[model samples]
Every structure is written in C-alpha cells, then in structure tokens.
Target: MKKATIKDVAKEAGVSISTVSNALNNSPLVSEDTKNRIIQIAENIKYVPNMNGKMLKARKSMTVGVFSSSVSGHYFYILVDSVFKELRRRGFGLNIVINKDKRALLSNVLSKNFDGIIVFDNERVGEHEVELIVQNQIKTVFLDRDLNGADVSSVLFDSYKSGYDLTKYLIHLGHKRIYFIEGEENTYDNLERKRGYTTALKEIGVEIKEEYFFKGMFEESYAYNDVISRFRLGNSQIPDAIVAANDYSAIGCIKAFSRLGYRVPEDISVVGFDDIEVARYFTPTLTTVRNPIARQGIRAVEILMDMMNNDMPGVSEHLAGEIIYRDSAKAKVL
Candidate 1:
C-alpha cells in the first residue's frame, strides 16, 4: 500500500494541490463545504501530514517541551499531568524528555523543535546554558529554580516560608529537641526549606546541632534506614520531634519508629512536607505541607504561552504551601 500525500488527496478530491493544502491548513480561502469534503477524502485515504513540513511552513511547531531529570515521584506525576491537560486545552502538543546529560539537554533546547519549553532539572540546566537560552531568545519557564530574565520565567514553591511555618508550629506545640531529615544536597527546594528550618530554630535561640540532621535523599527507604540504624546503635537520646523533607521521608521515619516500639505523636512527633495522596491515608496521617504542585504546572504553561505569543518579558512567581495538621505530629509531653 502506498502512503497518501497532499497530491493524492487533491487528486482523490478532484481539486488542485494548492486547494488541498489550503483546505488542510484551514485557510479561509477554501469554502466550508469544499474544506469538509477535502478533509473527508484525506481521512478516507488515511493521509498523514508531515508535521515538520507544516512547522516549517508556519514557522511554529505548536508544541511545548518539558525537560526534566526524572518524573518518578508523586509531585512530578501531578505536575506533568496538569501541564499536559492545560496544554491540550490551549490547542498545543506536549513533548517530554528526561535526560540527565547536560550536553544532550542543551542540544535539545537549542534545536528549536518546540515553540516553548518548561524546565525542571536544575542540575542539567546550569548558568551557562541559561545564558545561551537567553541569547537565543528561546522562551522558557523553569519550575525548580527562580529565574527571571529576557525569554525566561520561573514558577517556584515558597519552600522557605513553608519550612519556617512548619518549624514554628512544632515549636508552638512545645517541641524543643527537634531533628530534620534533609533531602538531596544543594537542590533549590531542599536548600530553601533547610534554610527556613534553621532560621526558625535560630530565632528561638535553639542551638543547631549537626547530629540532629539525617540524610533522607527525598527517599522513603533512605529515611527509614537512616532512622532505624541510628536507633539500633543504642542511641537513647531521641528528639522530641522529627521533620522530614517530604511526605515520603516522613512516612519512612514513622515506619522506622514504629518498628522500634515507638508510637508517632506519642513517643515522638513526626512531620513532613508535600501532602502527597497517601499522606491522608497513612496510619498516622502525615502532618505535612500541601505544596501547590498542579498550580505550578498550570502557571508554567500559562507563562510560557504568554512569552511565546505576546513576547512578554520574563516573570517570577512563587506559590505558597500551607501546613496541614494531622495525627503524625502533636504537642510534646512536658
């Protein structure tokens, strides 16, 4: 079987190639009846248009690219889902590429295959690449880092405020000996949250102890092992409360404490950030911060569209997170 093209559609519909092309492109020069008839013939012949050719003609791909390192966690899942839905609603296609290679990622961004791009991987997109993107005038919206300049915008979570509020809430609950399970080192969100936690503790005149910090790497298993191993070494001095980087880490800490014959919110209080779906259903119902994951995606697309269509200048927006009190954390027993 032969593949049908615009010429084939024109021949089958008894119209010229230009007429067929105009009809397919929805040009007003073609009448509605002729356009419908040509479209029907094209569909009947199973004609597939060349997207690259069409993009070249129109000088627009009508697609947006999302670049990220990994879309493994619940946060990313919700964010991508929202972004796809919003793009579809706006009559745009989505292209997602997950690559840890900086060179490859930069190459894709410079290819100009997409009308705009949304970035999530901070490590892959460094200062030099960002400068190149600006120089090329490639419209981009960054979700992980706050960056605002020509042809670039950013949508970020107010992690610092969320962290400070959570810490202050725990202090209000009379928790003094507090511990923190840190996420990936040097990541924007992780660093901001840690800064907030430390600043709150400092304001209260609480001495920051290095031993109180544990490595979670934003993984449940890592947090679980870190907590369990520390306690297994006969370290009897347990903190009054523990704060995890995210909900998964918080749940891991809870599990570890449970296995050690400790009850959450009773023997020790635990709190986390990012109110993931399972947070509400967990045994102790995570006391966590509700990050606006979906909102961030929606805003990123909106900003990118504006930049691509209206040549709008880059803008920075920060969404706030609210602490949801649950069964996992409570006041200390004085």
Candidate 2:
C-alpha cells in the first residue's frame, strides 16, 4: 500500500493544498474548525509530512539557506564567506542554492529545507513570492532589494548616495563631458546607482545625453567590448571621463582604453563602484566606492538569527559606502 501525501489529504478533505499545509503547520490563517477537519482527515489517511517540514514544525533545522542568482563574482565570494564563518561560530550550517528558475526557487524555499533564508536574487524572488514566504512564516533577509514584512528584512548598500557622491567628485575634478556605463537593467542596485549619477549631472547644469550611456551588464568582458566598439565606430565623441557601474566593468573600460592607445587618467579618466579585491592591484589601480560587502553578510546573519531565535520583528538596515580615490582617475587639464 502506498503512503498518503498532503495532496491526498487535501483531496479527501476538499481543501486547498495551502490550507492543508497551513493546518499541518498550525498557521493562524485557517479557522479552528477547518484546521481540525484537515487534521482529522490527514490522520485518517495516514498523511506524512516531509522530514524538512517536520523539522520546520519543531523549529530545529539549525541551518540557513542562501538563494542567489549567481555566486561567481568576488563580491558574492566575500559575502558568502562571511556568512559561513558567522553561522559556524553560532553552531549552524549553511546551504546555498543558485537558480534562475523562479518555480524551482519557490519550491526550494517552501520545502522548509533550512530554518531561515537569505535571499540575493531579486529577479527570481519578487513581491508575490515574498508575500507567500511571509505567509508561511519563513524568516528572510534580502540583500539586493528592500522589503519589510512580519518575518522579512532587508540589508542593502546605499547605492544612490554613493553614486551621486562619486559622480560629484568626478565633476569636481574638472570633468565635464562624462559618459556612464550601466549594469543589468531593472536591478535595484543598478537602478539606484544610475539615478544618482543622473541626478548629480542635472544638479550641476550638465546635460544628460542618452548617446553617452552604454550597457556593460556588470561584466568585465561586456564592458570592454562596449568601450572598444564605441571607440571603433568613430561616430561617438570621446568623453573626458567615464563612470562604470562596478569595479570589474571599470577595469574592462581601462583595458579597452589601453588597447586603443589611450592612457588612463591621461587621455580619459575613469572610475567605478565596489572596491573589489582586484581594484587596487589593477595596473592603473581603480578609483571606486567601497561597498561594505563583508559587513552586509555579517549584519544579515545577525538580523536573521534574531528573527529566528528571538522571534523579533523584521527591520531594514542600510549600509553606507566610502569613496576610494585611486590612480585611475584625475583632474582634467584645462
């Protein structure tokens, strides 16, 4: 004889799968009478919840899950490493899942595989999914976007202010004709950074030219090719300075300028955000905004632990950035 599943119990009780799940988890959304009916039906059918679900009910998984879109960059490496060390010190384990499929991501999240989750994939987990997670009472800390819920918190970098300040600094260095490189479209950090750049330009009475904007996709090679192609086309005028979305893209822009026989900060100044490990080691040494990557991870863990252990309400925290002046950029010679 085959064992009974939640779906089988739901069918027998004529209730939704979510209703069955809520009843089993003792969620308050279901009425007392409905909850009792579901429980009785589940018992009659011998329905058995998954082991992870059982752990969730008992609240003893002793682990956290990190859901990310991609974990290949230097930024993610530092963030995850910090989270790992912090969790280890507290006697907990870590699980990382990288998936682009929203359905699979949702399933993994709802599976209760971990006690709490730290989400970095804004594309996969949007407003609707977040609501479902909250309904299920999963403690979550979002790294890439800002959201507040009963059990959801956000830890974010102050991208807008940093971008504005960096651009203002460039303008102060006597740069007038400035070009901007963009990251992936519609991302929270990317959007905020772009907004700051444009705001700074407008405040200084500088015209924001659409032709000066180029897509770099936050990748070094993409930024390199974008720069090289623009220069090779000969249709666009060379700007006095260029601002890239991140350090990797900035380094790529530098390499492209070098290949075109243009000297960095001599022929054209350049700057980027996120002072990654390689920023200082690059030939010209990138000038950038230092994002608190490790601190973000550490603080995220602290907040999640508080929610999971102490039953604290979620809160939002914003980390600020610092300007790191380096050799890659300089004042324009009048």
Candidate 3:
C-alpha cells in the first residue's frame, strides 16, 4: 500500500500537482467540477494531509495550541469553547492539550508544533513552566489567571471584585459573621475571592473568624457534612449566610441545608460566584456574580490572533463580573 500525495491525486485526476494542492486548500483558481473530481479521487485513495510534516516545513503551524485543565463541566470549558470559535473566525486551527501537572503541561505544549499557545487556569503553571513558555518564544495569552513573572499579554477577570461585591451585598442585607466556603487551595481565583470577602467584612466593621471558614469540601456531600458537623459540635453561632467561591460550592451549600430541613434565604442566605448556567435553574435561582466565562474565551482568541500578527502590544485586560440577584440570598433580620 503506497501513501498518496498531491502528485498521486493529480495523476489520478489527470491534473497537475498544483491543481490538487489548490483544490485541497480550497483555492478559488480551481473550477468547481475539477475540485470535486480531485477530492473524490483523494477520498478513494484515503489520502489525508500530513499536517505535522507540513507544519515543520512551513516553520509556522498556523495552529494555536490551547492548554486546558479539563474539557468537562468546569469553568475552563467555557473559555475553551470561546477560544475555539474565535480561532476559527480568524482562519487559524486550534489544538487542546490537557494536563494538571505543570511539567507535563509545559512539555506537551512546548513540544507541539504550534505558532501560539493559550494557558487557562494559570495556577498549575510554575516558574519552570514559565521558563519553558518564555524560552519557547511563542506568542502566549493567559486567561482567568495571571502569571506573576510572564511579561506577555493576558485577559483577566476580577475574581477579587466578584468575591468582594457579593460578600458586600450580603452584608448590606444585614449578614454579619458570614461563613466562606473556599475553592481549591492552590487556585489563584480562590485567593482573590477570599481577599474580596475579607475586604467586605472589614468595611462593615465585622471581623473574620477562623472558625467560620472550611476547606477540602467543594461538593454537595462535603458541604452537607460540614453543616452537620457544625451543628453536632454545638457551634452556637451559625453565620447569617455562607458565601462560596463559586456557584458549584454555593449550590452544594443550599442542598446541604435543604436536606437538613432548612429553607434558603429564609433560614440563612447564601451567595456564590461564576453564576454558571445551572445557577439560574436551581430550585431557588442563585444570586451570584455572573462571570463572563464564554466571552473571556472569545476575547482570548482575538487577542492571540493579534499576537500572531506581531501587532500585539503589552497590555493587560480584565473583564468585570456582573452580579445577578435571585431568590437565593436575602437581607438578614436585625
């Protein structure tokens, strides 16, 4: 069995190699009938383009490499979706590389034959990873998280503001001694959100309590157990409300109370961040900071394209998170 090439397709179609190339690349010079005939012959011979070799020869892959944490029901998915759409619109292809470990992520991304790369959830990135990325000399843009030492383009969202504003809103509703459910320990977003929470409490003359915080529990079962443990341990003061780092944690808190025979906003108010799609459809719609997850994706690609064109200037961009009020949170009574 012989591998087919442009020459083979051309020979089979009784046309020149250039004609085959033009047809495959969708060049306008080839007639519609000729293009169809060439494509049919290539298909019959199972001739697919060798992108890897082509990229090597061209010295520019014309493809953007995307490094995502995961492509499931996470915030990263929203960003990846937006980037894919924007890359296509800009006439560039995309490649997604997923790995949680910094070393592995960097190895996979840097080794790939690509012109540019975008890093999502930058918390996993380390100094070594930074060195790798910088050493590669590839155009790069970071989304959702920032690299401390990387002197490159980034599009960020104000997680701190999201946390601060949401907490402040709860405080204005008379919530004091608010409990904070944190996100993953190493995540930059979690740290910023906590800062915002602390800032709000400080502004209201309310001191943050060590006992009012919990960790290692981001899911519904974890939240329910934490609430139960607090009750069983005779913890007298249940904060007026619980503020989660994101909507998933917030929803978990709500479910915990519901199972324990408590009503939301009526018994105790709760607020979450990110305002993921499920927030709106919850039993009592969530009151959260509406993170522009999808838009961030779209902007990332647009910026990366600018970087690709050598027109990218040194600039840091941040998108504000909007607050959406729903039935989940309410002012506490004096």
Candidate 4:
C-alpha cells in the first residue's frame, strides 16, 4: 500500500489538507472535536506530518543536547569542556542539561528540539525512558549507559577494570588496610569498580573490611564529611590507604585527612579514579585511574554526530582505564 499522506487523512476525515495540517500541528484554529476527528483519521491512515518541510522552514539548528546526571565536579566539567570543543570544531552547538529528574529528561529528549542528544551515564534513567528513545526514533548516543535498544547506542568505559587495576596496584604496594570511598552504591560505575576492588583484594587473601567502607555521593563534601566523622569517632589510627570511587571524593578525603594533621602518602595513602586536571596538581598530586575523560567526551560527540549525519548507529566502545602513579600514594612501609 502507498504511504499515507495529509491528503489521505483529509479525505478520510472529510476535511481539507490545510485543516489536517493544522490539526496535526495542534493549531488552535481547529475546534477540539474536529481536531480529534482529524487526528484519529490521520492515525488510522498512518499519516505523518511533513517534518522535512517544517525543518526546512526553521532551518537546521546544528545543535545537539548533552545531558548528564550531575554537572558539577572536575570530572564532568572536564568532559563538558572537551565535548564543547569537539562540537564547536564540527560547527555544531552543544546544549548541556543537568538531568535532575528522569521524567523531565525524557520529555526534553522526546520533544525533538535538537538534531540528536548524548546522555551521560545516569542511574535514574530506567527501561521506560529507554523505550521512549526507541518509540520516538530519537538519535541518541549513550555515554556509559550501555542501553540495548533501537536508535540507542552507547559509549562505555571499562569501569570494572578501572577499579580492579588500581586496587591491584595498591595491593602490590603492600597496602592491606585499604578503605574504600564508594560512590553512589547503586550506580553502575560504582558497582563495577567495587567488584574490581573486591576481586583484587580476594586474590591476595585480604578479607574486605566492612568498617573501612564509606558511602559517597560522588562529591568532595560528602567524602570530606565521612572522613571527618570517622576521625571524630575516636579513630586515631589511619588505614594504609583509601581508594576513592572518583577524584572528587579522593580530593575530599585528602583534604579532610590533611586538616587532621595526617599527611597523604606519608600518613595515609590515597588513590582515585578519573584523572581530572586538579588531581595532577593537588597538594600531594593524586594517584588515580586515567579514565580517558576527554576522549570519552570526544568519542561521545563523534558518535552522536555520525548518527545524526549518516543516520546510522555508531559503534560502541569499551575503553580500558590505566593507573597513574603520583605523590598522593606510596608503597606501604612495613
């Protein structure tokens, strides 16, 4: 059967093509009853509006949206900056949104206000939201989400390896009393990294200490508070080292530890993931996992632009993390 057109909808509804157009666009010129009749007829006949004409009328915006669950912290800022630069180089505008609510995020994405969108890893996004992406046929590149669906592709980081490699390195340094600053326990990155940490510890016969684990919200203040609270709870001795989920938490731990007259590496070694810029220049210089943050940004944009321009699904990638040793952590002394 031939694809239905506005004329077909107009004929089926006993209305003019112009009226059908108005109804399809939800123009107020059509009465509510008439609009509903036209819409039902259009749906029945599978008629689609002339989006190309509408797009041409407005002109290509060359704009894309980038949504992140949290926009603060050095990690996100660095990634945003990199993504911005990449988009700028390609003559595409980048609109960044901090997704505070999943419902609102899905609404904006489904609105088709941009050519395409890149979604950073978000635990708040559920299966229903992913189905919306498929339902609307939105061109989306998911950063670290690894969602499986039509018109939804992903860019992933090997977070489990990121955690395991760093943890194993700390173990190699003879640090058995390793405390963990876990970030958003429910998040995929945190879970993967935690697995790696535990795996490395288990291999070396070091039973993971439950008391040494602190919950983190992937922020500096939370980590800072947790460290301070532990000290106030009559803790005089420090763990051999603390492995934080991210650089922000690690920095917070280092600051809190420093304020308590504890020197990093000398008093308590610290390790972090995501080698943000400040991590390399902090007081003791953080030892961290180089998370390819900039590359992640660049890759996200590349994939998004490819999908937008070629109308193709971009290939997914799983990048490995590497340990970058610095002054923040040193071999434990026997």
Candidate 5:
C-alpha cells in the first residue's frame, strides 16, 4: 500500500488540504471537534508527526540571511558585527553574504536559501531591483536607506533629524556660511540629510549658495580630493564651517583642510554622521551623530525571531541616533 499523505488525511477527515494542515498545527481557527477528528484520522492513516514537515507546510525554512553591498568598508564591518551578535544571542545562527555586483545581489535574493533576509547596503541598491525580495515571499528588513513602495521592515538612522541637529549645532556657534559635503546623489539618507541642512539654514535666515555645496563619493580620499580641487580653484572666499555626510568623509575634509593650512573649528568648524570607532580617537575627536550601529543588529535578530515564530504583526522599526559633542566643532568667539 502507498504511504498515507496530507491528501489522505484531508480525504479521511472530509475536509480541504488547508483544513487538515490547520488541524495538524493546532491553529486557533479550527474547531475542537474538527481538530480532534482530523488528528484521529491522521493517526489511523499512519501519518508521522514531524516538526520539520509542519514548518515546511507553513512555508518556513528555519534560517536567516543577511547581506551587504560590499564587505570592504568599516561601516559594513560594524553592521555585520552587530547583526551576528544579536542573531547569536537569540539562538539563531546567521548567514552573512555580500553581493559584489547589484545585479548579482538581486539574483541571489531571488534564489532563496533560508527564510528571511536583512540588508545593510548603500542606496545604489534600488527598490525595483529588489522586487525579487518580495516576490520570493522572503521577509525583508532594510537597515540603511528607505526603499519606497517595498513593503518590508526597516531600522534606519534618522538622517533628516541628524542633519538638522548637526547643522543647528554649527549655526548656533555663530557660523553662517556652512559648506555642505554630501554623499552619493542616489542615496536616500544623503537627500534627507541635505534637506535637514537646508531647512536649518532657512530657519536661521541664512542664504545657501550653490558654491558651498559639494558632492563626493563615500571614501575619505574622494572627499579629500573633491575639496582640495575645489579649494585650489577658489578666489579666497570659503565657507565658515563644513558638514560631512559621514565620519570617513569628514576625515577627508580634515586632511584637506590641514594641507591647505586651515585648522578645524578654528579656521572652519566640521561635523560628521555615523560616528564610527575611529571618530573618537582622531587627533581632534570628531563631533558626529552616534548611529545605533550595533543596536540595529540586535533588533534585526529580535525582529527575525518574531518573524520566524509568528510572534507579532509585520514590524517596522526606526532607531534614533544621538549627536556626540567633541572638539571638532567650536563656537566662534567675537
């Protein structure tokens, strides 16, 4: 005789395949009488009770995956560290994968390995490019940038608020003309942070001239070269202060400023975001926003566990960042 199957149990119970599954899993929707009858029929049919089989029926694979665009950066290292820590604390081993190319990243996500995935990558990774993330029925949580219309969980730094706060700090110190150094144009945080800077300037009755805005790559060298090239071309008028998108870029600005015989916070005040480890130990410690880097990792695991266990509704969380005051910024004394 052929082995009994879910179909056999469903047929024996005179119900649909779904009804039999719900009965076997003890889902609250099933009536006590129906559940008891289904269990009796499953037993009589010699159906073996297996937890793995139940999980399979529920479309769960019992594993989690995390991705970063590239594993070469300091921020990526921080994010990976936090994610692993949290996942392990929750008793879930994590799979860390980096997709060097954007196209391949999408392809990897389309090819499912485990249950859910969390992403911490730059904005070059688009919402449409990640449509495969949703189509695969894989739960997602985006760490850094906000992907519009992609229905997924996110735990990101408050970029707009951080920018506004940082700019306000500079302005309050009597700096009027502030040079704004930005990240990639396609990045959401870059745009939001710029918006905050503009908003603060507008509120303080300061006019923002196009000459003071500079866009550079995420690398310190890129920002340093961009600033150096622009400064060398200038006719002696420079902004009184500078706001960098991140600590790496800020370090670049500092290096360029020093080479040009300009002192930070004395010749020009500077501020940065995502206060990475090196920010604190630098010559003139960086005044920047403390992004909840490690906390996001812990939270991702908590959310993933909830997702795996069906503990809560689809949750989206936003973590806040606090600005750390240090010697990099100073009030201009009359």
Candidate 6:
C-alpha cells in the first residue's frame, strides 16, 4: 500500500475536503454526530491524527499578519501598501492588527490562525509571549525592533543615519538655535533618531540646551501642543530651526508657527523627517530625510515567505536612507 491520505478519508466519509478539514480542526460548524462519524471513519482507515500525512495537511493557513503598536497606520502607509500588494502577488492573505490590547495580540498569534506574522508592535508584547511564539514555531519578521531568537527576523530602518545626516545638514547651514522635536518615549526608531541628532549637535561643539528639546509622541497634536504651551508661557522666542521627528509633526509645527506670526525659512527654518507625499508640495516645500517604507515592506515580506516555505532561521537586515533637501530649511548666516 502506498499510504492513506485525507483523500482516502474523505472518500470513505463521502464528504468534501472542507468538511474533513472542519471535522479535523473540531470546528463547531460540524454537528457532534457528524464529527464523531468523521473521526470514526478516519480511524477505520488507519488515519491517526498525529500521523505525518494528517499533520501536514492541517499545518498551513496561507495567511500572514501585520501588527503595529500605533493606533493608526498613517505614518507607515507606504509600507502597508507595499506589503498588501506583495502579499497578494504571492497568493497570501494579509491581516493588519493594531495594538490595543496585549493579551489579545498574544492570543491571536498563539492561535496559529496565520502561517506567518510581521510584527511592528512590540511595546506591549512581553518575553513570555515571544517565548510562546518560538515554542509554537511561528514565523515572524519584526520591523524597527528585535526579538532575539532563531524564530524571529528583524528589519530595521537606518533612522540613526538619517537623523544624523539631516541634523548635520542643518548645522552646516549655520543653524544653531535648533529646536528638536523628538518622538515616542519607548520606540526604537525614536531613540535611534534622537541619538543621531544629539550626536551631530555635540560634534559641532554646540552646547545642547534642555529647553530646545521638545518631547513629542510623533503626532501633530503633540507638536502643536508643545508650541502652544511654549508660546503661552512666554520667552518662546522662535528658534533658528525646527527639526521635527517626522513629516506630520513638521506640518503641525508649520501651522502653529504661522498662527504665531512666524514664517518658514524666514524667522525659523523647519525640517522634517520622512519624505511623505505632501512634503514636497507643502508651503516652502519641506526638507526631510528619505523614509524607505516601501523597500522595508517588500523586504520584510520576502524574508517571511522564505521562512514559511524553506524553514529558514530568522535573519536581520539594516537599511539606510538619505536626506532630501528642498526649500523649507534656510541658512541662518551668523
């Protein structure tokens, strides 16, 4: 005898493939009697549940998940778009889950509903959850963060380099009164970019002022409120330059500055990170660094597919981005 298969079981049970699958997975759709009948028929055919034939048939789901820590995906829209297209091309389904509850996120992954997952949210995920992911043999690719294990891959953007280049360019333009708008407190990208900015400033022998550092959550509202609070409290003389964490915050800073009777590249030069679509057309044409969202998305999906198909161990990739200079930032000639 060659071997018994799901086809053999299905043939004996006189049921569809989906029906057999549902019965094997214990789906509620199948009534108790039908479920017992299928199991009895399968057993009669010598089809053990743990046999390689049965296990392999039930292993794959052909679905991948993309989870993010942020409430919204606006900042990383390009990445999500690329991932969506790539997944479609590869005949895989994409599930985007946003971070709202930690337990829910872990449970979803552990449930093995997806063949693989590309995680962008790690803030709420704990070590135990990661261990469970490893134990369950879940395929994962993390963005801008690392989970050290054989089962996890990491794809990190070169935020540090981009931030360094952007800040150094502003410094070269003779801007010293630089007000740096930083992003979220716990994010890896935020910390790396801030380090790059501070490093560039230190190399120039500029005394870093505490007041020049504005803590932000990489949001328009945070940037806007920072400006309002500073202006209301007085002594809020316009800085020579404003380096926002990203384009959204940069745009918000521009709006606030306009209402405060300030002009871009005139009174205070503004620079943004992440070359979003509107950055080039915005008033004064914002100068910013290139954010390689599309590239990251494509590469992440590629790695995930490899892992899913070839049983490859997790790997890491670090990509670099460059600065895009336009008219927003002006030289503050001393």
- lDDT of each residue in 17-135, candidate 3, tens digit only: 88888776666899888977886787678665544423322437778888867777767677777788888887788888887854356446655477777887456665445554654
Which pairs, if any, clash in model 3?
none
TM-score pick, better of 4 and 5: 5
What tens-digit string does per-residue lDDT give for candidate 6 at 172-218?
A: 89887788888887688888888888889899888888888886678
What is the Å distance of residue 116 in model 5 from its true position? 0.5
**lDDT per residue as tens, model 4, 84-127:** 99999999898887777554565566557777788874665655
Candidate 1: which stretches are off by over 4 Å? 1-59
Q: Write the per-residue lDDT of candidate 5 for residues 88-191, one digit (tens) a residue.
A: 66666678778675544654554456567788765535655455454444567777665423335677778888899999999989998888898977676788
Point to the candidate with the largest lDDT. 2
TM of each candidate vs. truth = 0.81, 0.83, 0.77, 0.76, 0.77, 0.78
Of models 3 and 6, which has the larger lDDT?
Answer: 6
Off by over 4 Å in 2: 1-57
Error of 6 at 315 (Å): 1.8
Q: What global local distance difference test value does model 3 have?
A: 0.75
Give the deviation of candidate 3 from the true structure as CA RMSD: 13.5
Report how far residue 290 has shifted in candidate 1, in Å. Answer: 0.6
Candidate 5: Cα lDDT at 283? 73
State how far residue 294 of model 2 sits from its true place (Å): 1.0
What is candidate 3's CA lDDT for residue 284? 91
Q: What would you estimate as the lDDT of candidate 5?
A: 0.76
Candidate 5 positional error at 22, Å:
37
Alpha-carbon lDDT of model 6? 0.78
What's the ranking of the predictions by lDDT, best on top?
A: 2, 1, 4, 6, 5, 3
- TM-score winner between 1 and 5, please give it: 1
Better by lDDT, candidate 4 or 3: 4
Give the higher-TM-score candidate: 3 or 6. 6
Instruction: Please list the Cα RMSD from the true structure of every candidate, rounded to 1 decimal place.
Output: 13.9, 8.7, 13.5, 7.5, 13.5, 10.8
